[model samples]
Target: MTEAFIPIFYFSGTGNTWWVGNQIAEELQERGCQAQPISIEQVTDDEAHELIEKAAMVGIGYPIYGSDAPLIMQAFIENLPAVTGQKPMFIYVTQAAWSGDGAYFMRKLIEAKGYQIRWAVHFNMPNNINADLGWIITMILKLFQAKLPHAAERAAKLAQHIVDNQPWIMGKSSFLSFGWTQRFFFRKGFDSSHKNIWSVDAEKCTSCGRCVRLCPVDNITLVDGLPQFGDQCNICLRCYNYCPELAILAYKRPYNPQMFGTQPYQGPVSEFKPEMLIEKK
Candidate 1:
């Protein structure tokens, strides 16, 4: 019999989801299962289908945005081919705080595609959005550090459950689902108008084009050596958070890098780089 292997398709803006997904993958590997964490942005449609078709189980991970999965992840799920024979799948989400029904939202989407969900979990990490806050950021970082081991242990247990075929479904509730529905509609409306919300500070911008390279959706481009925003932005905050010069500004509150001199969160992994998410040709 062939050994079970799982592929975790994940999207991370500032690295929290990527870190968590890798931890889970590592734990799965330690338990004698083959697993790998693949960035959703770097995956091609044909590659995704092949991975899903050959895997014993599938996993999806992403950061929770506005109590739901990011737009890119939602599109990935929507584009997935429905599985035959009810393939086993699991979901995990990373968030700074309460995610409401974020995992449940993904569960419903995947279940609709004929995958039997075996696990759904969330991990609270440092707040990437509010990285500019002074003492608050420090406090959150401390909390994240304290919770790191617990989160990793939980991930290990999740792997063990998968290896043992034990089901552990989380973040599902009628009450939370109701709230999620309202938030989802509001988020969709806000996202539609968010294209023009980002502006580049030409003075601070170094014309390095890092934002253009880091953008998952190709929503940014260089015009006259300056980055320009487009209508397809999923608002992953990658360009904003990963900008070396802190030049990218969002119209939303808490995104004022100029006024706040916001410190960008470089993700949990110290060696992480923006170029790592870029697909290599």
Candidate 2:
């Protein structure tokens, strides 16, 4: 008799973590485990609790922002109620530029809530989403300025890691340290200090409200016919990352034109993970 093992959960803004989560789930299932994929977008507290309760081996996946996981993913994990059952957990972090000790933090928080941290891994994917247009330009310039073919190299290196679980020897990519941002984010990203993290560019914005509708948490609104974001922004930056016109700035950087998907993903290996897709009996 075989046991049905379920591993589910991830937070993706601009679809990076979502992509990565699906890959990890598939890999687990390929090893003969029953893996499930769950998105943190539009996540409700009650639903999260139920999923966490049912997962035999839970996986928490998110992108690396600065030195930590996305604010939205952090909030989701913090809100989960303590489960009576014990399960082995894996913390996965998907990133393009920099990744901090995301697994380290997750293990700490989950342990506080009474759970076991079985393993952790930091994996890099392609930079599908850029920080801002200004940042896009900056990265392009840097890409050309530096003679190194960093993208191609990173992709090759990450793919090998995925297939063999080998350690990557690439240099560090994180721009800032998580220790600097941890204290404040643990409270919430919507606090006064984090308000400016997501802002609209009036000149670039056409009042489409795509950001408003696309936001899983309903954090944006229209005030005076212009999009006005409330205090609760999770800073997923999906508004800007997925915007048709690229109107949102993570801080003040312009949206990059290259954000059109040339970069190799730092998240999931592929869309469906081929192996994880569940077919009807």
Total clashing pairs for each candidate? 0, 14
State, as a TM-score between 0 and 1, how close model 2 is to the true structure. Answer: 0.68
Poorly placed runs, candidate 2 (over 4 Å): 132-137, 140-193, 197-204, 249-253, 256-281
Q: For candidate 1, which ten residues in a row score worst on lDDT?
A: 252-261
Q: For candidate 1, lDDT tens digit of each residue in 1-281? A: 12678989998888888888899999888888889899977888789999999998999998876787777888889998889899998899887776667776756667788899888887877667643445665565446432567778879988888888888867677666664765667687776767667887788889998889888888999999999888888777788888878788766323454633456667776887767766653
User: What do the candidate models score in CA lDDT, each in turn?
Assistant: 0.78, 0.58
Output the number of the lDDT-best candidate.
1
TM-scores of the models, in the order given: 0.87, 0.68
| RMSD list, candidates in order | 3.4, 7.0
> Which ranges of candidate 1 are over 4 A from the true structure?
131-146, 178-182, 185-189, 252-262
Q: Which of the numbered candidates is closest to the native, going by highest TM-score?
A: 1
